[model samples]
Target: MESRQRALVLHRLPYRETSLLLDLFTEQQGRIRLVALGARRRRSTLQGCLQVFTPLQIQWRGTGGTLQTLRQAEALSLSLPLTGRALYSALYINELLCRLLVPDVSYEALFGQYLQTLCQLAASDGQYEPILRCFEFALLQALGYGVDFQRCAATGTLVQDQVHYRYQAEYGFVTAAVASQDSFSGQQLRALAAGQLSDAATLRAAKIFSRLAFKPYLGARPLKSRELFY
Candidate 1:
């Protein structure tokens, strides 16, 4: 018997000559692999609906373990197109989710944030740097690696404007008389604390900080999609 669900296609790869193997982020199932049989044939409805970044309602069967077969899929929203840098950024987000999020885990809030981020990136006129940073922070929080930006991780003092600090992956941010060479500016840290996502400089700094913070969790394997941005 097949169960119906909503999912976003994070990644898809060709299987044999006509089918596809899809890595999907679902509302209830988290991440799962679905086989789309004969999807590559010309004029196939599944071919058009199963593209990455597209939102769809999918039906599949096979015990929710591995290699389940998709039974039916229908589009849930208008297609959002992402090009150039936005395209690469979308790919990076997908890669991050694919690598970090485990199968069968329920991350509904993070899933919603992921969808929102993709829509924002596709809009073009909006500033996406902040959206991306916010999504990254939310992802970390969902995965139980949230940082404490409201106060010093060391002395428990409220983070002040004049204090220099260094962020450690396991310990959040700590005040240091001699700050790390790569530490972000006080203004940047303040902006992050306030959840202000409009400043380009702050967004840039936050991205670097997020990369450092995610390193230990990511292990030695590099995110392949990140290379497209360089």
Candidate 2:
């Protein structure tokens, strides 16, 4: 049976001579690996459409295999021109999806969020933090490791803005008797939950939360794209 899906090109590598191996985040199929035969050739139309951060319509026919053969791919839009920090941020996004997402399982909501993140990165406005934090939050939720910034895991109550809360990597946020390295102000927590990145402190707290939230899945090595920012 033939499978047609809309996908975001995550990563692609040269396979043999003229062919390419692709990692795509698809709405219907999640993270899929497809072999694009002859895609690297000069005359192949897919060579232009197969680039990163471009919306693509892909058709493939396969099941019960580690890889699928791409039947066709059409570019729905032009490639996004993300430069400077935005480009690095976009690369980080791709790396995260490729590293964490389970193959062949559909995550439609995550896919939508990924597309939205790409759009924000393409803006070239240099406001990468807020968008990145939101996407990371959403990604964690979609992957079933959601952070409970708005609620206390122990008390099962709404987090208080005046209180201090400490984040436990295995657990969510809990009320803290004393502020420490892992603790953040409740106001900052609430602000982060609301996607409001107005203050310097809140941004700092969000950055800490991002590290804690992703620490479990990221393994020993640091994210390579993260280094590009500084």
Candidate 3:
């Protein structure tokens, strides 16, 4: 007998002759892959429910070592259809999760953030840059690489309105003078710290800053979805 689990379908691919391999982000078990037997056949029950970016309630049966088989599934909701840039951005988010997150690492907070981001993208008429940046920050924090933007990395003093600062990858932020050659701006840092997303200039700056921050984790492979937007 297999255990039942609630999961978010993160990614899926065709498997075998008529099956599907699903990469799922679950509530209790974190990420796992399951084989959906004969899911491609017409009228197959599992075919319609399993899709990227959708929430799913699923049950699978397998022991400790082998790939599990999906026994039952149901769609939780109708995911908002994202098109054009929004679609690309959604794919970018998925790519980030595929690359950075480790399977079976329980991160309920990060999962919540992911769901929130999708909802934001689905509804907002605003630019997606700010939404993506905010999610990036949240994801990093959940993964234990959160940056400290409240105080100067050099002086350890609380951030002040009149002072400029620079962000470094290894060190969070330092006084402008001490930041040496790092790339960042005091205004942008403050804006992010304050959680203001409506400012376009601040949003652009945050995007650049986050790109630099996430570089190490992304390795040499460029995110293909990014190209669709750029």
Relative to the true structure, how large is the alpha-carbon lDDT of every model?
0.85, 0.88, 0.79
Error of 1 at 98 (Å): 0.7
TM-score for each model: 0.91, 0.93, 0.88
Using lDDT as the yardstick, the better of models 1 and 3 is 1
How many clashes in each candidate?
0, 0, 1
The candidate, 1 or 2, that scores higher on lDDT is 2
How high is the lDDT of residue 61 in model 3? 85
Tens digits of per-residue lDDT for model 1, 1-230: 67788899999999999999999999887888889999999977898899888889999988766689999999998667998888888999999999999887889888888888998999867466777788899999999998878678878877877777788888888776775556765666888878886766777778888988899989999999878867
lDDT of 2 at 106: 87
Error of 1 at 93 (Å): 0.7
Q: Between candidates 2 and 3, which one is better according to lDDT? A: 2
lDDT of 1 at 197: 64
Best TM-score among the predictions, by candidate number: 2
| Candidate 3 weakest ten by summed lDDT | 178-187
Which pairs, if any, clash in model 2? none
